[model samples]
Target chain A: MLARVFEASGLSSVQISLLREHTEKIRPPRALFCPFPFGLALGKPNDPEFQHRVLDHAFSLLERPSGPVLEDFPEEIVPADAPVTPAEERPPDPAFELTALRGYYDRFVAHHGRTAVGLTGVPSTRFRGLVRLLERYAAGEEIEAPTPDLSAAQYARFACDDIKAFFREARMEQYPAENGPQIDAWFWQQTAMGPMMRRVRDRMLASGDRQVEMLSYGIYREPDTPNPEWKYLTPTAVKTDGG
Target chain B: MPHLKHLPDMKRNEMLTFPAQVNHDTPWTPPARPLREARLALVTSAGLHRRGDPPFVSNHHEPDYSYRRLPADTPAAEILQSHASAGFDRSGIQRDLNTTYPVDRLRELLMRGAIGSLADSFYSFMGALRNVARLEQETAPAVAELLRQDGVEVVLLTPT
Candidate 1:
């Protein structure tokens, strides 16, 4: 493990281990095993109090005057979002969703003083139109990139990543209690963009474009995650909002 | 990590071969002092980098043993995570990078003198490495020396 390598170099280190099995196997000098979900090394996001508690635990392992110490983190983190459930409302169009989320996202930016959007160099204000153009390509229609510097495929990759980032950031603003997986399930299982992007990915693969397939797979879905199976959230999962 | 256990068959099959990497001797290094006085740095396996830095290689056959240095003061917007590991949930870090990196919490510690100070920058590596040998043989010492030179007395490691 990396902690062992660092320790070998005469640096004392303590790590927050997400996997107890791996920690037990590798046996780093000092590690605090957290039972939190994958990718949440510090438990819940947006909660500094919990994050500080996790950090304090990991750092305190440094005080043990011994070798190869591993401890379990004490607290059990209850997920912030409600149980993953079928959405009672139809998956909204990206245009309407983007427009509706803009104000809350702006508030998020104002409150946090930063955003994870802007990876594609396109301004946030124009995301709805840009998403419209990008989605057209996902549907197998050919379209040119907005700028000459990037190709349509390349721009699509960037656009895809940026739009998803925007959605997550904005969604967090509206649903601060939702955990990470809950938010991701909402995007991939309950959003129109999810299936549209899947079409873009499938088309790329169907065209024998290995490079693009690899690129889009990295951007849109984690190939190993339970996502992207394209099975859930069918018409039965939809309900009429208001006639 | 539930996701690791519940990986798609492709990944689950691959992860079962990690026992070979775990056979190394357990190395130990006692802390020189308490954490409150020790200068600290973060080392994350979250595949994060600044905007302009090249990403980790995007496939499983060949892993990129390279690392990226992210300035501690970099804004959340300037940071980017390019990990493409299967079944890994990125949405948490996407919402608040502190879930994995916790630089904000570290900054708070530096302000309160919960620790002496933070290194000017942090180190990052992509997770889901099939080749830990190269990382141990090469990149680890390279980064260790970098930390040594930077006067970092302790490290808090986080992974995605």
Candidate 2:
């Protein structure tokens, strides 16, 4: 994606990594990695109070920035060498399992129903992929290599390709498909992802890393090219003269 | 169901909701050395996205997710017009919030020597996401890689 966009537009770009494994793979202008938890990459939530402090620290790294800076979160929530949780230790609840899956499927329909039909042409197949992915994740199965790059274009293709398979997999008739009340409840149930993301975000918040991260760099830059030396990496404006 | 009444506070100051004040003399702690000096970048979860960009397609949704990068030289008017997600009181928000999510302000600081230097770049994205697992697994990593390559030192995040 970076290569495609950057090369095409002649725009400079950068990438940050929280994991060391990606350093060589991404090959951006520079990179930094923090030992903070997943969602709280920049800082924790609700602690806007503390997040500012962390950002203050992260900005300090910009001076003479080099290849990649992989630093630990300023604060420590877990030991340097903590043990990973095993699947057996975190046994799944069958009842919660059913509910979670149902909820996820329901949500899949609500958010994507419009796009699903347009892209997939058949909505059921999208549900099948959701069920399959959720079941696999719940069972603690390691996802195979090359997880599908569900970028905007690719997702549209996936939806279109798998529309039919969804009906076969979900077996919509088994449940009260008419009013879809149960499905609605399940959709709300899936809302738990927010709290879950927040939980992990809390961990990052606890770690105390403030530097902001971008999803795709330079994709938002203006068209006119500024002087090479006049680099505006942050949110700065450039004066433009009427052509 | 029942209705109850409580006495109001006697203190006049208690009613104020926001910080309402700032102590410029107080030692202002800066972000990390790199982040503190580097041009500022912002990422928000306000979902202030363009028309065509893939608008947070994950099954999870966060309407409040929004973000914007204020160029150091960016005009306050431009900031106001850039994206609707830059929601806040126009006056105090442009300045006071700069003390927090100061992307454009930071760059100006660096240019004017108010600060030493700036990281090569910075970033922003909408703040809200429902399916956090994908957020951590896919989004964070993608963002991390982007920041790393850009050599962004400091990133200001405004979560939805």
lDDT of 1 by residue, A141-223 (tens): 89787667555776677677777777777888889877666777787777777666666666655554544555565555544
Model 2 chain A: ten consecutive residues of lowest lDDT: A212-221
Clashes of 2: 74
Q: Which CAPRI category fits model 2? A: incorrect
How would you encode candidate 2's per-residue C-alpha lDDT over A90-144 as one tens digit per residue?
2133234334355444553443231112222223434444335433433434433
Give the alpha-carbon lDDT of every model: 0.73, 0.31
Each model's number of backbone clashes?
A: 3, 74
Chain B structural similarity (TM-score) per candidate: 0.87, 0.45
Candidate 2 runs further than 4 Å off: A1-16, A24-30, A76-243, B1-39, B43-160
Question: Which 10 consecutive residues of model 1 chain A have the lowest summed lDDT?
Answer: A234-243
List TM-score (chain A only) for every prediction: 0.71, 0.28
> Tens digit of lDDT per residue, candidate 2, span B31-146?
34433244434554433233223333322122223333333443332322112111111111211233224454445556656555554533344432222334434454565556
